[model samples]
Target: MSFNEIKQHSKARFKCESNELASIREYVRLKGLSLGLSEEEAFKVSLAVDEACSNLVKHAKKRSLSENGFYICLKIYSDQNQFIVEILDKSQPFNPNSVPSPDMQEYFKQFKRGGLGIHIMRSLIDDIAYFPAKIDKDYNVLQLKKLIA
Candidate 1:
């Protein structure tokens, strides 16, 4: 399919795992490039999306009840010069903005190994948002967007 075709596309649901993240990244990169993104911009979008997917894998594993794994939906828009990646998982709801800003001084003292995912994602993407799923309401929704040239 062509780039314009993809821009008009939207998938309602899909499942993914940590191992499958690479393929998803590649797919987003190609779609971004086709929509006029520079290689560097495409890479940034891919990496941001990968981080979101990885978060789902790390946090949602225990909550998954069936073989479906985690659900993801991607929407690409050329006219908008942007791509939206939405991930849904049965993990506890987390507000990215609510995460304590990283403190380098406390990092070593408190011995917290992780909590940088949101920081990295925010830096890479044009926008990020979190929302509680409306129905089948156990899941949390993470939305990310990156702008292309």
Candidate 2:
């Protein structure tokens, strides 16, 4: 669906600190379950969001709404078939293409600690899209979609 259409649907915005991650995860989890997702499916949704927020807390250097805080806007859209989640943040813009798909065998051999969030998001969600923040806009937008099975 178009971004405008998605934004017009059910949505919520969160401005919180790193410690507030659990609350955001719970919100997504409950929304997923309430929307009829199986527990496992809802957990996946929660985990994906958790990973995204964690990345921001770890890497983003932007000034928060309050000291040591960050802002995230979540927009949820539904139809007869699927659910779409859009997460917007003021984190640094990322070039998804610049990060190559990790080699699982090599990753295990090196025991890497980073670069796994994107992989997990891709694996659990049906589709993932990243939009860099434009010069005119101060936020990066990441969209995750999961199709009902």
Candidate 3:
């Protein structure tokens, strides 16, 4: 089902920070459990969501106290026995697929420190897509999903 189908179940606009990571992780875990996911599946989804949020914090702009910190929006829905999580971040526009595969041999190369985020994100989720926000002020959207079974 689309996000609108369960929009009411979604929680939007969470603070983004190294310290706030745990809360986001727990949030994902709790949401997954509500969808009938086992502990293991929920933990996996939590870790994946954490990794995605970490990437946003590391690469996105830092917010002052006067401004809202990075935004982490989550939507929960089940596809048959599988659970899907959508995370939207107010960071720079990034397309995970657009990044090239990392080269192990060149990993130590200081200038080649790219694509690792995309790689980790890709490994954790079953499906991912990037969509530009229409508001022209919101961050690029990154959608992630996983199967519970």
Model 3 stretches astray by more than 4 angstroms:
1-8, 62-69, 105-115, 135-137
Q: What would you estimate as the lDDT of candidate 2? A: 0.74
Tens digits of lDDT, candidate 2, 77-139: 765466677788776676443567799999999988888887787778888888887778777
Which sections of candidate 1 miss by over 4 Å? Answer: 1-7, 10-14, 65-69, 108-112, 136-139
| Residue 77 error, candidate 1, Å | 3.7
Per-model TM-score on C-alpha atoms: 0.74, 0.82, 0.76
How does candidate 3 score on lDDT? 0.71
lDDT of 1 by residue, 38-73 (tens): 899889888887777777777666756555546666
| lDDT preference between candidates 1 and 3, better one | 3
Tell me which of candidates 1 and 2 scores higher on lDDT: 2
Best by lDDT: 2
Better of 2 and 3 by lDDT: 2
- Which TM-score value belongs to model 3? 0.76
**C-alpha lDDT of all candidate models, in order:** 0.70, 0.74, 0.71
Which candidate comes out best when scored by TM-score? 2
Predicted candidate 1, C-alpha RMSD: 4.7
